[model samples]
Target chain A: MRIKELFINNFRNYKSLHIKPKENLNIFIGDNAQGKTNILEAICFLLQGRSFRTSHEKEIINFDSEQSKLKTELKAYNQNYSIDISLSRTKPKIIKINNSTTSKPELATNFGTIVFTPDQLSIIKGSPKERRRFLDLELASFYPQYKYYFVNYQKVLLQRNNLLKELKEKKQADTFDLLELWDNQLISYGAKILMARMEILKKLIPMAQQIHNQITSDKEKLTIRYRSSLNLNSNFREELIYDQFREVILKNRQQDYLKGQTTVGPHRDDLVFLINNKNITDFGSQGQQRTIILTLKFAIINLWSCELNDVPVLLLDDVFFELDSKRQKYIFDLLNKDVQVFITSTGMANTEKNLINIKKNAIFNVRSGLVCEEEL
Target chain B: MRIKELFINNFRNYKSLHIKPKENLNIFIGDNAQGKTNILEAICFLLQGRSFRTSHEKEIINFDSEQSKLKTELKAYNQNYSIDISLSRTKPKIIKINNSTTSKPELATNFGTIVFTPDQLSIIKGSPKERRRFLDLELASFYPQYKYYFVNYQKVLLQRNNLLKELKEKKQADTFDLLELWDNQLISYGAKILMARMEILKKLIPMAQQIHNQITSDKEKLTIRYRSSLNLNSNFREELIYDQFREVILKNRQQDYLKGQTTVGPHRDDLVFLINNKNITDFGSQGQQRTIILTLKFAIINLWSCELNDVPVLLLDDVFFELDSKRQKYIFDLLNKDVQVFITSTGMANTEKNLINIKKNAIFNVRSGLVCEEEL
Candidate 1:
């Protein structure tokens, strides 16, 4: 997959911007807060139908403008695609793909993107919510149906919690039957989410381990495990998982009612990273934690290539400076010749010197919301 | 401050190691999990009498050994001092200063040290607890009396919380008097903690802002505000803070009883970093967050120099590679030539190429818990 051209107006710090990026490597270089990351955020928004930087859509729009516009021309699977997106302060986002209105999930299925930013370090050092988010976001990116199940699970979980709160406030015992209805729906959706997560992890963990070995020269071993809220016993059967979920929900209802929240579901799941049987977050050095994240991302890229017969557009945001030249070389070597890569940096580091194929690179200088492509 | 000699025995992967570091610059190079960070942790242990990497002291002992020992000979404030520490899996730590037994807090006041690890990024991206810890640790490092108040505050908070739980379980209104006794102690110590934190931030924030400007070339302004659980005005009077703390605690006791936990105090305080009036954690990019942390560390170094008339020994672990040459130069320029610095990296980066003072540098190759010093 490659982005041939990008257009932006009234988005973030970019008032108006357009460029035809290189086929293989597009490097945006500038000092901090000079509108470098905004370019990557724009590309991510076009592909994912939402900004990855902020949850509030209105924040993406320029302060002087009521709405923001983004358009992209890309080639994927030897096919051309044009995705247009518009954001308004008070209205819903309007997305059009190839001149036809489309939903966010529809747009997501048509394009694949993997973004790596420094904030993503949160996956290792942050709360369980961050790890759960990593699982859901990656699963949704690869399998659209997984998004549906995830969304429904969240909805059922919210409804069930609200009912629990209402029952607690009113001191009602008759509402137990109503709670059971939400539980069944929760179990049905939660089971699918769990199964999908397990299936994906089964494939991802091994690739991550192999890539980690390569990155670290086999000095250490990496392993990832899915920790579900329910007591799963190496059983991948959906029916068994559903039974376990239902039984756990039944047993914990009283506590849930007392606490006024749903306690067991995919919402409570977490991913744990281990190196040589030691939990990385608790025991791994900062360098080891960083290596694990990079390993997982590269593994995802490899998985996308083998399973989909295509690769996602790679967005590397100001992370090159953090990696040594050897690790940087390893990353470039891992890339397929045709994979399109976009990188943001301060232009003062040796990242440019580490480029494996300089002939296929496009350099852009960004400053104060203005961008100009440089002659390479 | 300079370290003349370091001796380690059965620490982490190192069965035994010893070295005489350079006066100005000492860089330890190694790959992942090769005991590079263990060196820094050892120095921190000598000064702070605790392992910065883990709460469990047993983890620092080598697997084949039952205990670990560290000794450091250093010069600070025109005075030479030797500190020795030993850790055993089954017993308490033994700390000696100049061949005399001393407590951890006493050791902390005798020698100043500042450590910057990638894990310290938690100060910005982690929970309120992390921010509170940053405040407490810095204050405790500078003022040994602050450590006294902090420890007493924690003891009172724990006792108050336990009493709240007991009152809830027993349904006893008569225990309110007992709870009040704990509350009085909580407010007394919490007010001192609050006043100490406010005083430090008042000095640290301005220095951080100035240093941030230099790092970013005046493009961004950094501000750090202490957010207390108590409603505090501009007054710095301890009595004023105590009154506010008492009022808030009194009002929260009912809710605390219901939740069986203490809710309002210094334990819940937080530090917010803002770049140009925007929360850095929520709105700043990864580069910005990284720069802010570096700025704060530099500011702390500045504060130590101005107030203490002597700078702390600097320990930077694997963070130079993350910074560009320009920022790295800014850091080295900010340092006084007499300051001793210890750095750890993979030796594969351009960090060696950015050394400002080659003649003053001592390079060490670390692998499999062995250390070899190279003549520069």
Candidate 2:
């Protein structure tokens, strides 16, 4: 799977851009804010139908423009894909595939993209929200239906929490039955999300462990456990999980109503990485944690290749400079020549000098939101 | 200033450890949670009589222990300083300099330590609170009196906000005068904090700009503008800034009263980085933003060397891998051999290989909350 061409207009700092990127490594070289990340965001917009930078659509539009458009031509699975995104300040994003209008998030199932930034490297040491987001995005990218269930779960959770808040406001002690309807919907959707996420972890762990061992030279072993609030006991039967979820909700509903918040679900789930039975979050050095994220990212690549029957195009924001040259070499070695990777860097000299394995590469200089192709 | 020896007992995951560290470069090699950071934390404890990792002293104590002790022997400017800290589960941290007990924060002025982690690299792109904390800490470190005034400002701000809330709740127009007393205190303390921060940033920008230029190879020029809610424009007068701050507070107090939150003052301030007049916060590439942070951190080093007449003991928590080897070479070239530097890494090979300029070095392998010295 590769993006052959990309068109970006009024999207961030970019006024207009049309580029035919390299098949192996497309390097966008520019100083800070020269619209380098914008290209990655444009490709990501075509793949995921939204910018990873911000949820506010207005922020994506060029300052003087009311709307922005991103289009891409890609080859995936021996077929061509053309995806378009129309972003407007006052309205929601409009996504289209093959000239037919479609929902934004619906693109996740058909298109696969894996992005890595410095922020993701530190996600292991960050709050629970960061790890949960990692799980949700990967699952949605792997299995598109997972997004539907996860979205539904969030909706039900919000509505249920609102009802809980109202119950608290009214000081009602006997409003137990009021939660049943929301509770059932919550369990139904939440259980699917749980199973999907658990399945992803199952597939992800072995790959991560292998990569981590390779990185550590087998001196340290890596293991990841899905720390779920649902207390899933390897009994992946949906009915059993739902039954247990329902019971847990019932048991915590009084406290939930008093606090006016949802207390349990996939939202509270965590991914804990252990290196030889030692928890990395509490014990891992910065380099070790970064290696863990690197393993997880590579696992995503392998996971896509095996199960999804499609390879993900890698969109790396500063992978060249953020990583040491040795790690950069390792990553390039991990990626085969057939994989299309778009990398953003501040300068092209370092990329060319360090990434010795790249037989084909394209460089572009960006300034004041404009991109111009350059050849070495 | 250099740490000659460090004593650690019952701190973080460590039980008891005594290590004679080298003055130039000491490398801690370990997998995650092997008490590598605890060593740095103990040194930081000695310097500032507190842990940068946590606010609660009890949290530093080992689980089974009720107390922790950190002592350091240091040599600076033809003088020797022995700093001691007594940490307990039930009380505040006790700091003794030359065996005379002093407040923990008082150590900030005389003791200089500059730390860089993967976390600090992204601080510019994080929340406003993160930046504010950065300012507060640096200022407190540069001028310890700044902490005294800033804490007073916070107390007054809380009291003033509470009074505003009470005035709104009671619907009493006559209570506006009740805020006058708190307002004066808020203005006085707030003005001092604002001035102190402005002074530090004023000293920082040129240094950061020069280093950023060097890092980007003169392709990009960096500038930092202090963004304050008071709309300050280079006027360093405390009384004038205070007058403007007071007027702004009065104008916004009604809205503040209704919202039950303070809307003005240092709480809402920000540091905006611009590359050739382009806002880097919104526009900087991940690499460029990191370069900016790296420049800022080195500028801190230069700033301390010039003003304080004391070169700090550099406590780098895995900056080697966080930055590429090429950039690591740049940093090593930037530092002088006279400064004491402690770096933590997961392996010995990367440290010895990347840090090529070191003539003498110490390696310590950490495991299961213990540190054992190793010969490189």
Candidate 3:
């Protein structure tokens, strides 16, 4: 999948901008705060129908603006498509694909992307929430319906947490009765997430390990372990996992009551990275951690491509500058010819000479919220 | 000040390692999980007598080892010093400076180092707790006494928060009277922290702004505002701020009762970034966010230098690879010649030539928990 063109108005710092990106590689370069990342954010918003930067959609609107608009033309699965989206402060965002209104998950199912930002390093270094999201995102690309259950699970978890907090304060003896209802709802949705995540990891491990070995020249081995709160010894089964979850929740009820929050569940799960049988968090150096995360990216891209006939567009946001030249070249060599990549960097003069055969790539300079394509 | 030598035994992945560092630039090069950061962690441990990676000291002990030891020989304030630290599984860490036992904070006042790591970006892009810690770390350096006050403040805050939870759960009227006592203790300590943070920001802002302008070549402006929960308009007087805090806490008592968490305090504070008067969190690009964080690092270095006659050694743990050449250059040029810099990277063959002026720098290779100095 590739975004051929993008149009934006009153989104973030941009007043208005139109960009035509090449099918192979497009690099946006500029000084700091000159709007290099805004282009990538625009592309991400187009593909995901949302901004990863913030949860508040209204925040995307330009200052003193009532709404924002984004339009993109892309080719995916050997078919061309157009998407129009309007983000408003007073109303819900309106999204239309091919001139017909469509759900975000539906749009993502047909046209999708894989993104890596410098910030995305958090998956290897951040909280459990980030790790869980990493797995869920990989699962969601293959099973778009998995996102539906995943989001619903998150919502139910929050609702359950809020109820627990309130019930604890109220000191209701029968709070368990109400919690049982929330628990049932939580498990119903959570079980799908657990199953999908388990299945996806089984598929991703060998691929990630292979890529990891190549990156390290086989000096170290990489392995990713899904740390489910249920602590199951065997592979997932919906009924069996559901019962295990309920039992665990019951055992933690007293502690949960004290904290006024759910103490156990998928929400508290994490991913563990190991190299040569040693856990990365306790033992890996910075290079090892970054390499492991990079393998995860390749694993995700491979998984997404296997699931869809079209290769997913790759978005690299301010991450190219962070990698060493060897790792940078590894990324380039790893990218499939059919994959379209958009990269943002503060400067890329040194890098530009080494990408896209050193000639056939789109380069744009962004300044003060405006973008201008440079002649090849 | 510069470190002359470092010796580590049974720390993290390392069984033992010894290093002699250059006074100008010492770069540790290795693949991931090869103990590059363990070297920095050992330096940080010898100086600060604690691990920045984890609070639990036993975790730093090499697996199956009973203890970990870190020793450093450094020069500070025109005097040579030797520091030794040992972490054991069942006892508190022991620290000795120049053959005499010393408290960590007291030793830090005489021999200190500033560190920047990829993980430190949390100061700009992480939780409120991280932001608060950023402020407190800076404050503690200038006024080691400030740490005493800050620790007391945290203790009182936790006590007060716990009291709020208990009060809400029990629903007793007399609990209000007990709450008053906790509130007074909370106010006393909170005011000091609030005042210290405000004063430090006043010192830090102009320096950060100047560096931000230089980094951007005057293409943008950067400003920081300390957004305290107290929301004060002027520099603090303990009594005046305490009164205000008491009133605010009283006003939020109902909401606090509902949530069972204290809603007003330094714990809830955050620092806001602005570029050209636009909130950076909402408007800054990825480059801009990183630049702002980089400015904060420079500003901190400056403040620490000004407070002490000795130039603080700098420990860069896998951060150089993430910075662009321009940024990497800016940081190197900004460092005083007297300052010693320790850098860790996975690959630096290309960077080392440019960074060492093609001569006169120390390079070390780390592999499988061992360190070896490379010939020039």
Candidate 4:
């Protein structure tokens, strides 16, 4: 999917902005704080119904303004589409697709984008939650149904926790029965999630290995493993669906009460990173960790492309400057003539030759929240 | 920050994968359970020396493997650079910049990125913690010093908590002195964090408001308020240094004992989002919540770009189809021509023309762990 045009009014530093994109390469060049990233953020907002930066919606509006508006035109699979989002102070934002109201799922069916930034580098050095997020998102994109399951599972988890809290406060004897009901629901949904995660991991491992080999010049091997709290033994499917540990559940009740939280289940499960039988989190060096993450991401891209039958857009923030020549060339070569790429840099001089070779690319100048197109 | 080339081996799925990118648009498409997202994740790893996806490094290696390796050849500011990362079963990942080892801070300085994904939508609908993460990350990206402050503050917080736990368990009076010392450290660093956060918010509010207006079609006004547990009257900033809080801290000793944990401080503070004098979290519709998050991200991008003198790359993972056409167009128009763009879609059928028009764009066909170039 590719974006055609973007319009912004009172969004970030841009009071009113309009931009028409080049068919191939589009570059945004500017000094710091010129709102260069804001332009990309605006596009992200329109595509995802969210931003890549902050979490508060109010931050998008001008300090003195009450609302912000964004409009974009897109062309995907030989189709032209437009999306509009209005940020307001008193009500939920309004979203329109092709001049019609739509839900997030419906929107998911129309537009698809992949963004990369420096913060993502943490996928290598950061905590496990970040990795899980990466997996969950990729899964959600390819399997919209996974989004529903994820949301539903989270909702169920929250409700169950709430119920646990209530039971603790009330000091009720029936808490166990109530907990069982919730537990049943949780397990049902949780099982699906666990299975899905396992399945994805299973499929991802070999692909990641292949990518890792190419990136490393065949020096090492890579592996990804899913570690869950539930013991996957006996009749796997039957145990998940029918087996119950009433005693264990009851035993943890008091602990749950004292903690004011549920302490076990899929929520607590984690994905363990192992290299040749050793855990990466406990022993891996910084560089090793970085390679593992890189391999994992490449694996995801390859796996997703394979699954969806099309290439996803590639967004690289300031990462290019961070890599050495060999690694850099590896990534550069991957850009081949197929993927639509977006990169942000302080100056055009900072871009690589391949990145600068876009004859049909559009270049824009961003300064203090204003964006103006520039001739290459 | 544009990627010149990427190479991967035994990371997750690919035993070996190599690709050369188009200067402009590069797309990686695949089916469900494929590894498309993994590819971008690998780039993130190279950039941050960490994974944006998981906490465990070993998980990145392909299952049944002992190690993973990643190499990248990067060109930034017309300079060629290389990065190599090695993941092993028994040691921490290794990072080599131009074949020389470097620290994380140095790496961060060289490579900075901004990532976006659909899960970010939760920043709108999820809890305050999610929002705080959004802010902290933005801060870390623009102000690398903030990362240090954050790390120090966290360490102090953990130490303080540990002291509190000791006090509760030992019921010793002398522990108070030690507690006081930790508290002092906490306040000293905490103050810096508080100040930085406040300053960032101050600069961010105006931009956010403007963006919110555009996204909301000028229907709503948005504001972000930082809520700290400490009473920071002018004198309090000076008076409440760890030493000053001795008495109050002592008074809370009993409660701390009862809780067995630290109960007060900025760590527990929250950021409040308001729209027209109402808290959006409690009252805003789903769409509004999403818009608020979108606005916040835009604000972050603007703030970071302005502060860092560079535009961070934008990462959007399958977020587009979530917004309506108008909103989509808003985003499409917002990606300034100079910014490099990357996006992922299930199929080309849903893509926009502008996205398709990028001069050097390439589309890759991905299927079940295999990636092949799609003729444009």
For model 4, what fraction of the real interface contacts is kept? 0.00
List the candidate 4 regions with Cα displacement exceeding 4 Å: A22-25, A121-126, A155-178, A233-264, A274-298, A347-351, A360-365, A370-376, B1-376
Cα lDDT tens digits, model 2, B123-222, are: 7788878888887877776786887898888898889888877787688756677878988888888889988988888888889888777666687888
Q: DockQ order of candidates, best first?
A: 3, 1, 2, 4
lDDT string, candidate 4, A220-306, tens digits: 556666655556543445345334433344567778767767776656766777665666665444334555665666666677567
TM-score of 2: 0.80
| Per-residue alpha-carbon lDDT of candidate 4 for residues B1-376, written as tens digits (9 for 90 to 100) | 5666778777777666777665555566654335666676777788778876677788788776898898888765456789898989789888999999987667767776566664565565567778777778777765668878788979987887787777766767455667768766776777667666766777898899987777656767898877766555434443343444344455676676568766666576678888877676644433456567667766776775676655544455444433434454555555544344455544333445444545556677655457787766
Candidate 3, residue B285: Cα displacement in angstroms equals: 2.6
- Interface RMSD, in order shown: 3.2, 6.3, 3.7, 16.2
TM-score of chain A of each: 0.88, 0.85, 0.84, 0.79
Q: Write the per-residue lDDT of candidate 1 for residues B102-182, one digit (tens) a residue.
A: 998778887768888877877887789988888788887666689889999999888888998889878875557788899
What are the TM-scores, per candidate, against the unseen true structure?
0.85, 0.80, 0.87, 0.52
Task: Write down the lDDT that model 3 would get.
Answer: 0.77
Candidate 1 clashes between residue pairs 3 or more apart in a chain or in different chains: none
User: Which TM-score does chain B of candidate 2 obtain?
Assistant: 0.86
lDDT of each residue in A227-326, candidate 1, tens digit only: 8888887857899898998999999988998999988888888898888888888777766777788788878888888888888888888765455445
Candidate 4 chain A weakest ten by summed lDDT: A238-247
Candidate 3 lDDT tens digits, A172-261: 746587888888889888877777777788889988998887767787878788887787647568887888888888888778877999
Error at A285, model 2, angstroms:
1.3
Ranking by TM-score: 3, 1, 2, 4
RMSD of each: 4.4, 5.4, 3.9, 14.6
